[model samples]
Target: MEMPSLYGRVLPSPPAVDFNSAEGKRLFSEALQGGTMEGFFSLISYFQTQSEPAFCGLASLSVVLNALAIDPGSRWKGPWRWFDESMLDCCEPLDKVKAQGITFGKVACLAHCSGANVQSFRANRATIHDFRRHLIRCASSQDCHLIASYHREPFKQTGTGHFSPIGGYHAGQDMALILDVARFKYPPHWVPLSLLWEAMNTTDESTGLHRGFMLISRHTAAPSLLYTVSCGNESWKSIAKYCVEDLPNLLKAESPDDVPTLLSHLIESLPANAGALIKWVVEVRRKEEGRPTLSKEEKERLFLKENVLQQVRDTKLFYEVHGQQYAKSCCSCSSSSEEDSLTRIAAAVCCQGVAMLSGNLASRDGLCCRETCIRCIQANGDGLKTVISGTVVSEGNEQAVDMLLPISSPYTSSCNSTVSDEIVNYPSNTDVLTVLLLSLHPNTWLGIKDEKLKAEFQALVSTDNLPDVLKQEIVHLRRQLVYLCKAEEAGSHVPPSH
Candidate 1:
């Protein structure tokens, strides 16, 4: 007669078959030594559905066989158990199974580990503590960073020691720890896992240094979301692939021994846009509720539209050129042509200075020569002939000219010529002269004692040829000089001259 098979077909009993006795060694041998893949899968499937006692018994047997399969001194032994634990837990162990029976329970939790959940992680204190310890041990063996969970009260204040435990640790290093703390009771499932991976893989560009893993409740989220691991700036693509792709694969893997391999893949895949990726992930977590889910195309479009990369690129250009002062003066004489304020002021001052110097030189040349003496005297009635001719004669005659003629006469004639010149050049060089004269004190020229000078200045005041600007300045200066002279006369011993 044919022997019964564990699954499907039947075969003759092997020499080791002992159906009456339930032996751990025999069962493992049957599972592993089974020739076909069908037998192996059937055995595992049957083991998963068994009661706690039966499955635990089988688990113990599997453990022994696993140990014997590897050399005592090999590094593979510990890792093998870790792997078995993940697989057994995921597939439903044939051994003892805890029956807290939370909604979606272990199945959902395992699915979450594989990046299947949209809600945030919110485990009880006991669960969080247990998960943290396991993660720490596993990460340590693989030379990965360990992170811890931080918990605090909701809102009520008890005593100083009062605190409520929150979410558990995801990943991080010694210096900085990443906490997978929940903001709301129902966070989008991918948030916790994404945050965890970001904490683990972020690297700093400056020192190529990595930071400790960190996570805080939404209520307590840090101002900055980016975390760095190694010094170089990793790209967003690398970050997304490692955190979403590699880390999820790590959790679903059958052997704990594969942890190092998973970690190696993650570290090697660090992205160039790691910082930006972290920012995007955190932003998603925060705004996940009200915002519409972004499609891949929409995300790419928005990212490019915002032009963050372009802004970064343009920073230097903006500071170097566009930031400079481009202000221009809008004064009347600055040629209606737009120019900087400083440039306009400088040009005006320069033009005024040149005109004043030229006028002074012309007056001096005309007054000193006998040929031009009459014309200079008529133009600037300073008695230039008397002043200059006296010098050519004896010194004795020069004193008579100085004493007889009033000092005001020559200055008055110069003032008259300035007034007349303004009429000829109004709105041009006249405007320049008017501005200059307006800036001078009238008393300096008007106070001269020379009779001819006084007469000439009086005549200039009477000249109808003066431009409006020159006329206004002369009137203003005359009033000011009159007030000053009156004040001086009042204070002096000399009686006022009518």
Candidate 2:
């Protein structure tokens, strides 16, 4: 059946050509028979109609994605097809595409996330020769396919701009086949080499970037992970595939619980990005332990100002993740009871201090949370009980109740602690509070061999307001017990979880 189009209805014109067919080639041969076709490849993909006529770019991308054998929530093997509606719903919503068409970055990112090898290049006046060469090279490879973006005016076509695939090239005719994605709007046809080149050189209005071609190949090695996820479970492999793509961004999530992780992958990914995390962590410790200096006023001003913005960022994330419901805003915090404040603070330490620091924290980054996330672990102590079943700790010397030290720096410590005795569970009389504090906030309890890591970590742990129970434990252990600086610094983000 014939399709309706505005171009034919509004003006006198011949039917648009579909070069992939025999009749169209006969027409091309009769009209512009300059040379025999050197290379030919074609994948007939349908055009889109739902969003706006302007969605030609998306339609073209959908075509490329399907041809590359990458799953976009569906079957990979195809005589190839791109359902624009499904693509929009899964990744770019329709309204978003309508407002400001997609970018090559977004398209490439989608392809990359789908496990395709994507190579893109923008065309310039001098680069056309190289582009032609690359096109021929790609045409020879079965796994390779191309998406081309060019303005329509140069071709004297109906639309202003469009995206389509260059299915075949004729060194003989010096004409390239444009497998137009808007085949419903304009039939697939051949445009002269010079005209197609001119069209690609046109600047796109949306991104202010010149139009170009992106080559996608499905056959490639596995994407490199900074570190391997240790799980042999297939379900976990799926989640890890989805999670690692955004792990760095997840690290900056507003709250520890905002992007919870499974205790499993957390044990894996933490080591890979620990350095990036500590970069911010050291700053947090510094701000919380800020002190008046005996140095000149100039030095002090710079020191305080350096961390001002970082402090705001850290606190913003903390409060945003645990807003009024759990940790109230500064204005309303004044009315909360002291007990509430202590409990909330303790929860924060348990979460951000250990879980987040060790990547034991999580959010729905696709790793199925086993209710061991920071929010769960910090919920009424029951969640934590499952993990810290080894032993209990006891309160000790009552004299150290208020031993708040004026910690000067994150790396330097005047005090020291070694095991006061053998590694044994806390005594039967050990306070429940002490056991909870020790087990939950063990980042400060594990030891470190790296002197520099130990110092920076020691300073942060020392800065924490030791609850009376912790103070009693510290005094009882004669301060011999060490916390988790080395455990985390062991060059892996995964700490030893009980």
Candidate 3:
């Protein structure tokens, strides 16, 4: 039986030469002969078709990461640690990437976050000579791969921007093999190196930066064992403002007697919405405290595994004890009246103060009735119960939470006024304090006079536990935080325009 030819899918010339074409075949052969097909041979086995229309960048990255044998350090599925499009979401949220394709800088950022040594070059920053030199080197090395972020319109492809790995280089013909991740639209092809460079030389209107390329290879050092920052520069700036600006003001205005209130205020003031809050909290494993089944040694081992800031653990432990005392003192109150019960529960310190900050004291101006407000309280309480009871698991990944909190008003029972469970379990003091410590050095809080508060906030700032690359990134963010805070202090601050 003869197979049907799918040559019609091959894009016409002036754009790219399809790999099955005679010219492309000859280019591949020559590339192999010239020993420049090392990357092609290494990457071919791991090449993937993008799962989403806007996932070209992630697909390209997964190919390169797997080719270099870089472990993702987390399970991609049951018992498998591998690179996938879903795991490449350390820089931008996957939903955002799904709506609008990733940018060149973000691609490099994701690569760096995923344990790769990444060197990114914007079209404006590097000469064509430099690109060609890097391209040739990448093509010749099995360990290194180059991903081009370019405008597809220049190649006559039906898209604005696209990302694909450069598999091989035909030095004689000056053509490069593009292992296009969008296999549904196009096949692997060869394009003139200069034409590819021209495509990359265009501007990405979204970033106001020229599109370019990234050289990615495996990092030789051990990856970060515990913490990694995931949010963008803008969010980091917001954290810095809250830490260095809003926090100091709050501290100065309040007394040590108002510590619980102060902690609640800090949690409520955080810039991260529900989704971001979830991401931050899940990084730290939840400790199963007061489990009689586990011995003290077992409990200590479990605490060590909850690889979060030591101060955060201590603060949580303190809150647990504090909350228990508050609950016991109020145990004698009557629960006959529903309204009184709701009010009493609302006022109680719950979810390590996250429930109080997010549900009870959280603004409810838009809510339609008392039931909706009560539901919010209940959902938050339930979510916290789920978190502390160690029942929060999605599929096999304990860190994931794909559930949404149903928040329908009574008047419109079918309305889609739902919130992510992430938001329901929003930033507690532990989470906000972590951000504060990350944004401003702990020494900045030395002005506090409360012995207990001082002990909680006095945890030494140490970057030694972080990977060198991530430490460098944190240092950069700290510097940016300082500059932003200084600009605001000078009264010359201008809000950024979206």
- Model 2, C-alpha of 28: deviation from truth (Å): 8.6
Model 1 agreement with the true structure over 1-498: per-residue lDDT tens digits: 996543322211221122223432344334233321121222223122112312321232223223223111111232222213223332233232433211112222222121121111223212334444444442233212122211111111111111111111223211111111121121111113333333323332322332222111111111111111111122333543444344445434422233233223323333434332221111111112233234454344333322322232233322222222222211233343222232333233233222222221222112221111101122132222111111111212111011011122112222234342221101121222222222233333343344564444333324244443333333433332222223112211111111
In candidate 3, the residue pairs with backbone N, CA or C atoms under 3 Å apart (3 or more residues apart, or in different chains) clash, namely 274-423
Best by TM-score: 3
Worst 10 residues of 1 by lDDT: 397-406
Sort by TM-score, top down from the best: 3, 2, 1
* Best of the two (2, 3) by lDDT: 3
Candidate 1 vs candidate 2, lDDT winner: 2
Model 3 Cα lDDT, one tens digit per residue, 1-498: 997754325485866898988988988988999989988877999989999989999999999999999966556655466888987765677899999988776677677667676667777778889988988898898989999989887788777899999999998988888899999888899999889999999988987778888888885653432233434324554554566677777666656644455455444555543122112212222233343143343334333323233333344333432342221111212243211243333222122122112222222222111111222222222321112221222222222111112221111122224523322222233333343354455455665667677665444344444544435534444443443344212211112111
Residue 282 in candidate 1, Cα distance off native in Å: 19
Model 2: how far is 240 from its true place, Å?
19
- Candidate 1, TM-score vs. the true structure? 0.13
Q: Whose lDDT is greatest here?
A: 3
Name the runs in model 3 displaced over 4 angstroms: 1-8, 232-237, 240-498
Candidate 1 regions off by >4 Å?
1-77, 85-105, 111-498
